[model samples]
Target: MLSVSVWPCAQADSKAQRKGRYLPEYMAHPGKMLPAIAEHAITHYTQPGDLVVDPMAGIGTTLVEAVHADRMALGVEYEPRWADLARRNVEHATDRGAPGYAVVVQGDARDIVRLVGSDTVGKAALVLTSPPYEDSLHRHVRCGHGSSLTHRNPDESFIRFREILEGCYLLLKPGGHLAMTSRPKQCGGKFCDLPSRAWQSAIDAGFELLGRYVALLSEVRDDDLVNAADVPAHLPRHEEVHILTKPANSEVVAQRVTRIAA
Candidate 1:
């Protein structure tokens, strides 16, 4: 396994690059996964022609990155709006000559096993996704007009999240990896440590923890880190990427595969 602790993947041109790859309307998505983060996980955890899935795919960032890296991609999105956009994004990637194929299913991620079908069970090489943050994070403001945000019960949301994680466990190959990115945020003026909660959820879902890495959302300048999350003041400078695997003697199998490939 790759042992890097921090991933300095936020490039200067990240915004422009993302705008160019995705549809204009996708910019409104509340929690879109960074392309760099998706790319890094796909490159390290999967191989060409391998299957990569994103259970809570928002705008298909993982799917787009995976297909561009020559890996088949599958995504399950809860919102029909985002699912349509995700499907269009995959089509856009295909039109741009991405070699690998991709499909986006519109459904709840907790039903991922059924949504993806029995044929796909235990076939995915990697499951990369980022769970949604609190309701406050999803608020959209435009020209001094803010969209109405629905308050979510944290406990209920966490329970659904754990169910989704369990579904992801069933979708992976015996030695497949699950990579998730999340960060802490303020909920009702109180700090909510979602990453820690997600880590526990993965473990409860029968996955063996492998690594915990940081993917920086900021840039280094003049020997100092430039904090990009300035608006909320409490937003984290980096998101935690937790890597876990299905507990099917996966460690030994992964090491053996590494040796064979080497």
Candidate 2:
């Protein structure tokens, strides 16, 4: 487990340079993940030659980091443009001398089986991603601060989130791990407790809580507003990364024991 502030070299790409060109009006603003954060998570949770997956691969940060760390990476992206970018990024970061590879499939993550193939089911060593925060898909907003902004219908958004989590659970091998980054959202001038919602969803999908770590952002603009005297403080400058694991079945456990005995 990394310390709250130990993730080094965390930096955001400028919006002007994110996609290298003007995007279509319908394309949502890119919420690029920090390469350093992905690298740290990959290194901590996976081993060399292990398979790592990112269902909501945004520009391939997780894939690139995984390849750089000598882990085979598989990612699924909804948009073709972003999927292409992810492949380029992964190729640029790949070490030719290493045995690992990266594959990015352009399709909906909710249908991960079709995207990655049925053979990959129950074989991933780690599932890592920072999914789109609730709401603010078509707009840019800080984590947990946007309430009035709307993208997908509320019911649709929740269903998508739940489905994504369930998909992640289904793809993991028994005893494989899941790490996600999210924050409590603010709605109606109060905290919406999204972390708990995500936790419950993961539990419903049969994942056991392993740990939770709070990673603080360097930018305090959002926190400063929460501390303002006029408004009650409801949000924070940090995001929570929830770690979970799929329990190993008895057959899998017996196989492991026999291997150790041999």
Candidate 3:
């Protein structure tokens, strides 16, 4: 029952005021979703004691929030450095006597079922994450061990997005939800609708789009618009989180089982 209705423009708090403040080692970055946003999504989609997952759990934002919200958490990080930080953060959150447990597995999210085990398939209540934004970031930053880099090609990025969604679809129980954070991007003088692309991929991967929430990173100002001929003209300072769900029917479950097995 956490209501996000009050945050039409999204809350603006200094990075120091957020949950990430507890762990200064993992500074807030463009690739990571805000812990506040993740907490809101988790509470809205799942009740206490449910199992929540973040396949691309950078620095354990979703995992820590899930644990604090009294839901069991599972995170998978491809970068070894981030995986290590996530593991430590999870431990830190759990040691505080949070109601639920958290664990991070290091591996490609596309191979999640294999890494986490087939037993978790159809058992998770929610899968939430903010996937890589193709080549959005200009330069890579060192995340403790090494620089964090993602696929730069849009074509490869979309393909990887679909693969991750397909894996997440299998991880959810019938009626379980999948929520992802995405923002529109400017590509070669054209605006790419990543949220829509992800939605189509999720549908093809057997998920139904349920809702969309926009989280503002900063207040957009009219003066911020420069002499640029972009589609939106002024870049949106907000990112979107798309909520999706598996059909709550035995037939859909059967189809998912058949699809995953094959």
lDDT of 2 by residue, 41-156 (tens): 78888899999999888677778778867899999887677788778766665534434689999887877866798788778999987645544321244444332212443445
Ordered list by TM-score, greatest first: 1, 3, 2
TM-score, prediction 1: 0.85
Q: Which candidate do you rate higher for TM-score, 1 or 2? A: 1
Which 10 consecutive residues of model 3 have the lowest summed lDDT? 137-146
Cα deviation of 250, candidate 1, in Å: 8.5
Lowest lDDT sum, 10 consecutive residues, model 1, at 141-150
Model 3 quality (TM-score) = 0.82
True-structure Cα RMSD, model 2: 7.9
Give the per-residue Cα lDDT of candidate 1 at 223.
Answer: 71
Candidate 3's error at 35, in angstroms? 1.2
* lDDT on C-alpha atoms for all candidate structures: 0.77, 0.65, 0.73
What is candidate 1's CA lDDT for residue 18?
73
TM-score of each: 0.85, 0.71, 0.82
Off by over 4 Å in 1: 1-4, 135-151, 221-223, 228-234, 250-262
For model 2, what is the error of residue 14's alpha carbon versus the real structure, in angstroms, after optimal superposition? 9.1
Q: Show where candidate 3 strays beyond 4 Å.
A: 1-14, 17-21, 28-30, 135-149, 187-190, 218-235
